[model samples]
Target: MRRRRLPATALAVLALVTAGGCASSPPPPPPQTRAGHPERGAQLIAQYGCGSCHTIPGIDRADGLVGPPLTRFGARSYIAGKLPNSDDNLRRWISDPQAVVPGNAMPNLGIDQIDAQDIAAYLYTLD
Candidate 1:
């Protein structure tokens, strides 16, 4: 029989993980971004039913477990942990997830560039 003592930092991280669950408490309504309209993007997210899969902050009824929660999307350096999180890359991913990663869970949703830009803008506000 053996028991290993977890480091304090590791225990703290574990506590945060267990406590936070998926996302932080709902954030204030999203603000605007330089690339596109965040408000419109929020609307588009609702219209597209993106909340059906992801736990997006500030989006009502966005409590889903099928996909990763976008708690601090703007702070993330990568999109889907692959593509760099640049505006162009984000827009590309939003437009067609399969094209970028080939087997990602996020579907294309037939979103155009304009809408993709707005969605990206809104996502960036999650930080």
Candidate 2:
């Protein structure tokens, strides 16, 4: 019996097809907001350098991974491992993370009331 060899172009096409099948799907789009506040919240997270300690979605430069990832915060039952994950509680955590979780490395970024509220809104939509 004699072995038959495939042409170079045929082998390349087969390789490309196989590789494309193995590629992972793209990530889902970020949650939408009525008032478009998540954009502002994302800005605030960058401005305050929250990525230095925690991971946030939609912000590519935030590679810290030191703290918990905020990908699906809306599904989380608790915030800071204690307080319930509610709008008010999230605001508190963002404004003063240490207050919610004492001895935690996260610092108070001095976020004002409105920014805290916007951040909370954004975090809640991570689900």
Candidate 3:
């Protein structure tokens, strides 16, 4: 018996369909306590020079590249690959990252409780 061959276009379409069938969507981002106050956090971030090590969002003047950016912190699964992502955790990280991660590059900025809370609040809104 003789076999027939599909046209090039038909074969291409089939390949695309097969590849698309195997595609999967990414997981959802982590939840936050409340909407972020990026504006307020922005101010604190600049005042504390957080941009020197870590990157934060909405602060155009920030150019530091030592640490990760705070653009999508609210949705991140972990703060330093060990600590869970949450309002409380974020506050802890902002105030003292070394304590949570141990030997982490982040330093203790001596951020007050209220300022840390505000920073966490702002980070949570990145999503």
**Which pairs of residues collide in candidate 1?**
none
> Per-residue lDDT of 5-105 in model 3, one digit per residue for the tens?
99999999999977765225433446624544656877888889877776667766766788877777767777776666767777877888878878878
Candidate 2 global lDDT: 0.74
**Clash count in backbone of candidate 3:** 0
| Best of the two (1, 2) by lDDT | 1
TM-score of 1: 0.73
Order the candidate numbers by lDDT, best to worst. 1, 2, 3
- Tens digits of lDDT, candidate 2, 29-113: 3334423277788888888887777788877587677888888877776777677666667788888888777889778879987
Model 1 C-alpha lDDT per residue in residues 1-127, reported as the tens digit of each score? 8999999999999998778654345333333435999999999999999999999999999877998999999877677867667888889999999998898788879999999999988999888
Show where candidate 3 strays beyond 4 Å: 1-32, 35-38
List candidate 1 stretches off by more than 4 Å: 1-33
Shift in Å, residue 57, candidate 1: 0.4
Tell me the whole-model lDDT of each prediction, alpha carbons only.
0.86, 0.74, 0.74
Best by TM-score: 1
Q: Which ten residues in a row have the lowest lDDT in candidate 2?
A: 27-36
Give the Å shift of residue 14 in candidate 3: 22
